[model samples]
Target: MNPARFLLPLSLLAAVACSSDASKKDPVAEARFENEKRIGDENITEKQERDATFVVDVASDGQLEVELGRLAQQQSTTPAVKDFGQRMATQHAEISQALGVLAEQKGIVLPAGLGAEQQKTRQELAALTGAAFDKKYLELMVDDHANDVDAFDDMSEDAYDGDIRGFAAKYLPRLKEHLELAKQVQDQVEAAK
Candidate 1:
C-alpha cells in the first residue's frame, strides 16, 4: 500500500470528526438544538407567527369582555368595579381599535368571538350576583391582567412584525395598571364582605 494513500484516508477521517465537533460547538446551532427539543415537530415558522398573532388579537378582545363585564355587573352595585370597568372599557376599546388598524394593515383577521376560555368566564360571571359576583370578577381581572401583561411582554420581545411589537409595547403598561387596580379592588371587596 502506498504511504500517500494511507495518509490521505486518515486525514479525511480526522477532518470529518473535527468538523462534526465544531458544528456541535456553534451557539446558534446549539440554541436551535434547544428549541427543537422544546418545540418538537411543531417548529416555529413565519406562518405560525402570523397564526399565533390571531391568538393575541383574540386575547385582546377577551380582555375587553372581562373589563366590560366588570363594568356592567358592578356599575349598578359596586363603585370600585364600576370605576375599574370604565378604565377597562376605555383602555380595552383603545387597544381594540389599535389592533383593528394593525390587522387591516397586516391583512390579518381575528376570530369573531372570545375563545372558549373567555366565553366560559363570561358565562360564569354572568351567572353570579352581589358579593360572589364581585369576588369572581376581581379574581378574573387580576388573572387576566397578569396574563395580558406577560403576553404583551413576550410579544414585544419576540414578535415577528413591527405592528405586533408596537401593539404589545403600547398595551403592556395598561395591563400592569389593570392588574394593580384589580388587586386593590380585591382587597377592598375582601374588607367590605
Candidate 2:
C-alpha cells in the first residue's frame, strides 16, 4: 500500500524488460536466437550444430567420391588409374556406409546426393575420357583426399562429440592411405604423359 515501495518494484520490472529488449537487439544474441528458432530446438548448442554439420558434409563428400570413382573406373584408360578408381569406389563405399550409420544414430540428415559444386565436378569429369579423364580424375582424387585427410584429422582432434571424434580417428588412417595412393597413381599418370 506504500507508494515508494510500489515504485521500487515497478522500476525493477522495467529495468529487466529493458535488458531483455537490449539482448534482442544484440547481433550475436539475435543470430543465436535465429539459429535456435530455425532449428526448432533451443537445447541444440553451437557445438552440437557444428558436429551435425560435419556429419552432413562428410556424408556429401563421401557420396561425391563414390560417384567420381565410378566415373574414373569407366573412363580411365590407364590400368593403374582404373585400379585406383576401383579402390576408391570400394573403400569409399564402405566408409560411406559406416558414416551413414553414424549419421542415423546422431539424427543428422545427410544430403541425398552431390551438392552443386560436386555435381559440377562430376559433370566436368564426365565430359572427358581416355588419358584426359585419367589425368583429371587422378588430380581430383589427390586434391580431394588431401583435403579429406586434413578435415578428418582436425575433426578427430577437435570434435565436440566423443563418438564423432572417434569416428574421425577411426577413418583418418584410411584417408591418409588413400591420399598417398592417389599421389602415387597421379605420379604414374603424369609420368606417362
Candidate 3:
C-alpha cells in the first residue's frame, strides 16, 4: 500500500538486472572478437605485425648515409680520410643489408633510405672538408657509436625476441671496435692540426 517504497525497490531491481545483463555481447565487442579470431586463425603474431627495428637500424642507416655523403662532397681530403670514408661506407652497407634480412624475416617493412638521424648526420658531414670534415666525421662517429653501444646493450639485456637479442649481442663487439677506431681517428685528426 506504500507506493514510494514499492517503486524504489522495483527501480533498484531494474538497475541490478541491467548491470548483470551488461556483459551480453554488444555489436562492437562481437565484431572485435570476430576480428581477433580471424587474425589468430591466420597465424599473425605480434612480432610479425610489429615493426620492432630499434637503435641499431637507426645507427646503421645514419652511418651509411653520412659516409656516402662524405664521399660525395668532393672535399680536398687526403687518402687516409678517403680510406676511412670508404671503410665506413662498406661496413654500413653490410649492416644495412643485415638489417634488411632481419626485417624480411620478421615480415616488417623498413624505409629503403636512411633514417632521420642518419640523414641529419650526413647533412652535417656534408658541410665540411679537409681537417674540418675529418674532425666532424670522427666526432660524429664517436658520439653516434656511444649512443648505439648503449642502445644495443639495453636491447641485448631486454629484447623479447631471441633473434633481436642475438643480433644485438653479435653486433656489440663490432660496434665497440668501431668506437675505438673512431677515437683513434679523432686523435689523429686533432693531432694533425
Candidate 4:
C-alpha cells in the first residue's frame, strides 16, 4: 500500500474532473454568442443593426425578469412580493413572446436565455430566501424597471424602425408602472425589517 501512488492518482483524477466540468458547453450561451456575432457580421445598415441589437438585449432582459419573478414567487414569504413576482413572470413572458415575433419578422436571431450578467443575478438571488430574498428581489425589480423605462423611452422616441418605436412606446407605460410598484414594495419590505 504505497500512499504516494494512491494520492497522485486521486489528485490527477480530481484535476481532470474539474477541467471537464469547466469546459462543458452551455448550449444556450453558445447559441446566444453565435447569434450576436452573426448580427454583427450581417450586411445591414447601421440603424438596422442597432435595432437588432436592441431586440437581442431586450429579449435577454425579458427572459431574466421572467425567471427572477418565478424565483421570487417560490422563495418569498410575503404576499405582496409574491404577487409582484407573479406579475413580473406573466408580463415579462408576454413581452418576450412579442419580442420574439418582432425579431423573427426583422430577420434577427435573439438569444434563447439570459445573458452572463443576468445569469449571475439570477444565481445570486436564487441563493437567498425569506426577507433577504424579498428585499433583494424588490431592489432588483426597482433598478431594472427604472433602467428599462429609460431605454424604452429612448427607443420609443429614436428608433429607426417604426415598428420598434411603436413597440417601445407600447411597453413604456407598463414599465413605468412596474417601477413605481417596485419602489412601493421595496419600501414595505424595508420598513418591516
Candidate 5:
C-alpha cells in the first residue's frame, strides 16, 4: 500500500472523530446508567428491601430444609418422620424454586446454600443416625416450622411485593401444618426413646 493512501484515510478518520459531539450519550449506556442511578426505585422501599432480604434468608433455609429432609427420607427408621421428611423435601424444593424465580425478577441476590447457622445445623445432623437423628431432626423441624410459620404469617401481611405477600400467605398454613406434624413425630420419638 502507498504511504500517502494510508495517511489520507487516517487523517480523515481523526477529523471525523473530532467533529462528533462528545456530550451525545449512547442509548444503551444511557439506559444502563439510568438504571444504576435509579437503583431501588420507589416501588422498592426500605421495607421492601428488608422483605427481599427476608425472602433470600427464607430461600436459603428452604434449600437447607429440602436437603436435610431428603437425607431423612432416605435414613429415617420412623415411618412418620420419613413421611414428614418427604413432604418437607417436596414442598420446600417447590418453594425454593418459586423464591428463586421471584428473587431474579425483583433483582435480588440469594445465596446458593444454607446460611452459616443452617450449615452448622446440617453438619450436626449429618453426624447422627437412628433415634438420635430422628429425634434431632424432628426437634429441628418443629423449631424451624414454628419460626417459619410466624415469619411467613408476618410477611404475608407486611411484604411490599404482592407476589411475595401472596406466597407467604399461601404457605403460612402449610408451615403450621408441618409444625403440627413435627410436634406429633417429636412426641413419638420421645416416647420411643
Candidate 6:
C-alpha cells in the first residue's frame, strides 16, 4: 500500500477513538464541569436557588405569622382581634407543618426562625398594648397577607416542580381569603382608631 493510504487509515482510527472517549464521559461529571465554568456568571442552577429561597422564606413567614397570632391572642382587648389572632395561629401552624414535611421530602434545609425584618416586626408588635397593639397588628396582617398572596400566586404559576406548584395552588385561595378578611379587619380597626 502507498504511504498516503497507510496514514489516512491511521488518522481515521484516531478520530474514532477520540470520539468514543468523548462519548464515554460521565454525564453528571460533565454537567458539574460545565456548571463550574459558569461560577462567575450567575451560574447557580435555578432549581437550587428556587428551593433555597422557598424553604427559608416560607419558614420565616410561617414562624412570624404564628408568633404574631399568639401575641394578638394574648394582648388584644377586643374579641375580634383575639379571634383573628387565634385563627392566624391555628392556620399558620398547619401551614408550617405541611411546609416542613414538604421540605424534608425535597431534602431542603430551613431556618429555625423569622428573618431579620420579620423578627423586628414581631418585636415591635410585642411592645405594643391595648388599642395600639390591635391597630398595629391588624395593619401588619393586611400588609403581610397581601405579600403572602402575591408570593403564593407566583409560586402556583411558576414553580418548576409539580408538587410545589400544587401546594401553592392549593393554598393560594386561602391566602386570598385571609387577605380580604385582613383588609376588612384593618379598615374596622382604622375606623375605630
Per-residue alpha-carbon lDDT of candidate 2 for residues 1-193, written as tens digits (9 for 90 to 100) = 7899999989999999999987758788889989879776634577788888889888888888889889988898899988888888889889999999998998889899899999999999999999989888988888888899988999999888999999999999999999999999988888888
Q: What is the lDDT of candidate 6?
A: 0.85
lDDT (C-alpha, whole model) for all candidates = 0.72, 0.89, 0.69, 0.90, 0.86, 0.85
Model 5, which residues run further than 4 Å from truth?
A: 1-44
Task: Give the Å shift of residue 86 in candidate 3.
Answer: 1.6
User: What range of 10 consecutive residues in model 4 has the weakest lDDT sum?
Assistant: 40-49
lDDT of 3 by residue, 1-193 (tens): 8999999999999998899799667989899999989888665455333227573465455556456535634662755566666666677677767767876786656666666776776677777778777777677678878977887787777666778778778888887887787788777767777
lDDT of 5 by residue, 118-191 (tens): 88988888888878899889888988889999899899998988888988898888889889989988998888
Which sequence of candidate numbers ranks them by lDDT, best first? Answer: 4, 2, 5, 6, 1, 3
lDDT of 1: 0.72
lDDT comparison, 1 vs 6, better candidate: 6
Worst 10 residues of 1 by lDDT: 67-76
Residues 1-193 of candidate 6: C-alpha lDDT, one tens digit per residue: 5999989989999999999988998999999998878874553467557855865687788889899999998889878888888998999899889988888888778887787898899889999988999999998888888888888888888776778778888888988988888888777777876
| Candidate 3: residue pairs that collide | 62-118
Candidate numbers, best TM-score first, in rank order = 2, 6, 4, 5, 1, 3
The alpha-carbon RMSD values of the candidates against the true structure, listed in the order shown, are 7.5, 7.4, 8.0, 20.9, 11.1, 5.6
For candidate 6, what is the TM-score?
0.77
TM-score against truth, every candidate? 0.68, 0.77, 0.66, 0.76, 0.74, 0.77
Backbone Cα, N, C clashes tallied per candidate: 0, 0, 1, 0, 0, 0
TM-score of 2: 0.77
Candidate 5 residue 40 Cα shift, in angstroms, is 14
Error of 5 at 132 (Å): 0.7
lDDT value, residue 3 of candidate 2: 100
